[model samples]
Target: MTTVTSRPASAASMAWAGRASGVWLRLSVTAALLAAAGNIYALSDLEGIYGRETSAFVNQAIAQDAVDLAVVSPAIAVLAFLARRGSLRAYLTWLGAVAFMTYNYVIYTLSVHVGPLFLVWVAVLGLSAFSLIGGLAALDGQAVAARFDRAPRRPAGWLLVIVAALFTMLWLKDIVPATLAGRLPQSVSELALPSSPVHVLDLSFFLPAAFISGALLLRGRPWAYTTAPGLLAFLALTGLPIMVTPFVAQTRGDEPAWAVLPPIVGIVIACLAVLAGLMRPLPRATGTPVKVPVSRTDRRHPPHQDAAA
Candidate 1:
């Protein structure tokens, strides 16, 4: 392992991250408030906006909006507020929150047909996408890697791998049978939607990302140090929505997914614990260029440079 020691904070590198995200932070607060307002009114069946949705689907949406209002919106606002102080941990967490909103609103704008909140959803999605991009732009990958020099990599890596494996298996259990039967799956049928966007997203994008992050982390890859924290946040945030959805269903006179709760809760707890370990060494304020002692590998010339010689 490369042992990296801390040095004086580099005001230049860390300052940019805070400054760059400032405008986005202000914009996100507005968007988050709008989202919160939408969530509150959605439960009232405002203007019969949900008139066309299946009972199950409406319940699911209610559950999601509840979590968004009660947990996500407030959490992101706080993270953004903290990130404005230039903490790497806070900035990364803020980025993850924006990522989650971007992901959620994609489903809302594309799959759900609520005309009243459609524009609100679009606004949230656009802002989050842009903010995620901007936040990533300000991130110093090498600096972050150096900070995590002694953090617990293996547990976080293995947790990601296990989460990915379990989810992949869960989604496939529905998909493979449907593919074989040449029919739409029950997951879709219950929601009365033509297709399951969650399944598509999980199988195509998120699960693969989880597995890749975990694998790279296991190998002590530098990139993983920067990438894994946000991913861990994402997983932790998502578990809230999934855990609450079933209860929302029960309250709304729909079938509760009780069986899903135990495993999901367990995953959330494990992810949070490991994530804390990974982030423990990270500074509450980040604004420094790292200066790890040079080693043999560090002294090695690039292949192109060697060729030039």
Candidate 2:
């Protein structure tokens, strides 16, 4: 049986990857620390940014802070560890972490009106954006793709599309009515906010990326391999909290449980699908097998040959 093996990535690519990983690690850690501190320490009875009850807003903030610490912080730590070890899975996971941080901080900056943590949110936002750009620039799409099996690509892509479409429907369900009526969305009004940050961000950025990346993967484009995992990771991490936050709010008597339950279930299922697809193993490539060094650490040993397509 013939097999194909991957060659070591170019030195320049390796260097770039190392640098990008370092940047992501530092920035993510810093952001996580600052966010945890700010959210936990900076509590007060301040007016809502839009107009919702201050108490309600504060409760939501507390719940979200818990999610940040419990969910996001751990994910970032794991991804950073993986990236440091030179795993493609870690690299892709890092991308998602960066995206999540960026998206998350942006929301905090816009939504939290009267807090000392505003500056912290701004700093995190800038750092996360830069980290994402640097990380994506450093990635070698083909090399990354070569590390993964092709079988899950289509399914993962479709899952992303479905998640994105669901977000669009959810947000538009509120936005389109308000837009047509030339009035603010009821949720926006209830919150006393000028607009919904979730709606704005989803419509402008996350949803579009999810749809595009999913489409690219389905078409078997090389870039899709690079983009899909990160998007999936981002969706999974962000989607989980979004699913749970409503339940938290409901338990606090801030919202009805039934109102949010269906979406929560849907998002949970979709996130699981994306994660499962990404975790699929790489298949051996077809062709004559060849040996290559996995990294400098492995150079003293004989080259390990593996089949991968």
TM-score list, all predictions: 0.85, 0.81
Clashing pairs in 2: 3-287, 50-192, 50-193, 51-192, 51-193, 52-191, 52-192, 285-308, 285-309
Model 1: how far residue 284 lies from native, Å? 11
Per-residue lDDT over 5-58 for candidate 1, one digit per residue giving the tens place of the 0 to 100 score: 443334323433423546677777777888888888777773366778888777
lDDT of candidates 1 onward, in order: 0.73, 0.66
Count of clashes, each model: 1, 9
Q: What is the lDDT of candidate 1?
A: 0.73
